[model samples]
Target: MDKSVSKSSQPSGGNGFPTSSSNGRKLNKKLVYLCSIVMAVLFFLGIAAFVFLFLLHKNPKATNKNIASFRVDSIFVSRFKLSSSKITASWDIRLSVQNPSTASVSYQTFYTWIQYKQERLSNVTNIAPFQVRGNNWTAENGKLVAKSVRADEKVIEDMATEMANGSVNFNIGLYAGFWIGNEEAKRVWRAVEAHCSDLKIGFSSKDNMGKLIGEPIECILTKTW
Candidate 1:
């Protein structure tokens, strides 16, 4: 009886192999937890990237440099009335210009009358200083400048006389894109570099409820005459 030993109770493998049901269950649970952790990490990374991109889009000041083109719309001379005075010569011209961009913008316009024989320009009538608005437009800030071809009366007077005598065919700029090359316009142009800039003509339309309404800055025609 003393020599009897229990062989059935002894371990089957020499190494500590996980043969118990509890050990197997624990291994499966650990494997599942590892997989879940990896999946969560990947999902979090995707969400982070999406949020970053969305914020970039929402930035107001950030602009797309590669915007293919700036456009002008609904442009018309609208009306023209010539006025004569002993004091000075001035033309009352009304023009409507529009900026077609969804983003806010600023721009300028520049032009001069042609010195025709009978319509010989002794000087630029109704001369006005350059102005800009709507999108922070300014003439002083542009690296490239907008210039008038024949704004001075004396220089243009000689050219006008030459035209009247049939010595020169005097053609002056009547309409142009910029009218003049200036700052806000070069970065964002509705037309040429030399266009009139400093004029305030805009409109805001609202609904009947006194709520916010559509506000489109249209070029207002002042009494040019």
Candidate 2:
């Protein structure tokens, strides 16, 4: 009788192949954990940005009401002299400024001039800087003196007409450096212009004094730069 040989079957790399599959599973789990951590960081950053924008919209630095509060309180043309050759005049102006915000408002190096029919009649006079406290009002004064301004035939005619009418309308121009906050060093200065369309004054050919005709009129203020 012939003896039969028994055959045994076995897999290649016996248990090592199964160990490699286990390692692959562990690597996949690690990758998923890293992705989750990155997504969480992005979510927090987005939340922070949204909160900052919401707060900024709720509170603004300057408002229309606050800017509109600035006005010319009074104006006095104390003396106005007219001659065949030249014209001379002096005037006093007062400004009422109000600040409605929490920060202090400051005005500096202000200069003012008088105009008639878009013609500049006098030189600019410098006024000192002034500050208005938060939620408060402040009065500032300005003075102008025009001397020996050469008068033309048209100017004389205009003067006569105004004197006869008993009321002369003049425009006032103003330029100032301003800052809105308490930290003045960090604040930027800007130019301002004021126009007084309702200014009324009485001119007499015999007397040098020109009387104010009516109540103080409000001036329109605008930013130049």
Candidate 3:
């Protein structure tokens, strides 16, 4: 009697290897794992950024306290004359700066100016670079000179009226960049703007000399990036 023969049930791939469908499934799995790894890395980075911003938002008062403070101790005007066309003045400004940071602070790009009402009457003079120790105060004596500076009509009128009444109010403005670090290292840099307004200086008769009155004025401070 003759026996019946049956065909082989193995895959068609060479050397009895896995079929094309099985190879496709393995490649798909690899792609999935790669995508998952990339997404996980991105997610952690995003979380880190959010945490940093949240901490900054929650500690505004601490940030302000750690920056610094500025105060105008006194001002002496030796010569101040103004007209509609021109202005001239010599000012000796005594000021103090307090650094609350733990690191030493150095200041540069120091600028000082004088303003009458809202009108500026002098050029912005550059002060010498200086440094203040950590958690300490430093006194800076600044001399501002304005010679033949063009004056606005409103500024001259207001200044003359105030001088005639025995006292004139002017605003002293200062700006500088502060670096927080020791002499051997630098960590961060910041810009600060300080305005000491309502500076009442008393003058007698038509004399150009004047002295600051009342208490020392603490300047309003603003920080820039």
Candidate 4:
């Protein structure tokens, strides 16, 4: 009788290596497909973000409207103190602020300084912040007590002459920071400056002390961002 050997039925590749199961091949194909989809989505998202940021940078004014709608409505000098070395004044001022944009605006820590002939006389700081609604006007009131302003001989002389003339010309400087939009929307912060020129303060001399003659005079106001 002749002896015959039988071979197994397992599948093999060209290299004669055992092939993977059909289920395992299917699972590998699914994983590769899923990875490709995820990569495509991420690439599209990155491109969209880049375009948005580019547009935002190009049109900054659209994001933050200029805060030019600020003005000095009125001012009232309640007390005045003049001395040989320094001068001090206290006053209440009212401001009219308008938000022209559709978004709200807010500011913190207001400061004001009184100047005469380009000389800094006094300054007040640390006032409270204010907020204005969209496309609306609001009145903000604050009191300022200026610190003692040291003066030289020429300044004192000019002050005396102006007091004798019954009107003193002064300048007022204002500074603050403003933020656009509310908490829900993106916010932008900017610095603002205001200058009121030729503010004429009228006073009368009584018993060697200066007394306010009438309401504070309105002055030319200019603003910069």
- For candidate 1, which ten residues in a row score worst on lDDT? 204-213
Writing each residue's lDDT as its tens digit, candidate 2 over 1-225 gives 233222123334464255567779999999999999999999999999998877654433433333425567677786686777677888887877666656676877678888777767788998888887777888888888878777676876787678777778778887766677777575544455667775777766577667556776666777654
Model 3 ranges off by over 4 Å:
1-65, 183-186
Identify the runs in model 2 with alpha carbons over 4 angstroms from their true place: 1-69, 184-188, 204-206
Give each model a TM-score.
0.30, 0.66, 0.69, 0.61
Compute the lDDT of residue 13 as modeled in candidate 2. 40
Residue-level lDDT of model 1, residues 31-66, one tens digit each, is 999999999999999999999887765432233321
Ordered from best to worst TM-score, the candidate numbers read 3, 2, 4, 1
- Which lDDT tens digits does candidate 3 get at residues 1-225? 123222255556757789899999999999999999999999999999999888766533236544778888999998788777788889999989988776778887789898887777778888899999887999999888888888777778878888899999999888988777765543577788888899999997867899899999998876555
Candidate 4 displacement at residue 123 in angstroms: 2.7
* Tens-place lDDT digits, model 4, residues 1-225: 123222333344435565667668989999999999999999999999999988765544364345546666666665576778787787666767767666677876567776778778776555689888887988777676666778776887888788788777776677777787787457877666777776666665653333233454333335445
Q: lDDT of model 2 at residue 172? A: 83
User: Using alpha carbons, what is the TM-score of model 1?
Assistant: 0.30
Identify the candidate with maximal lDDT: 3
Q: Flag regions of model 1 displaced more than 4 Å.
A: 1-5, 12-16, 20-27, 60-68, 72-103, 107-225
Model 3 residue 137 CA deviation (Å) reads: 0.9
Clashing residue pair totals per candidate (backbone < 3 A): 27, 0, 0, 0
RMSD over all Cα atoms, model 3: 8.3
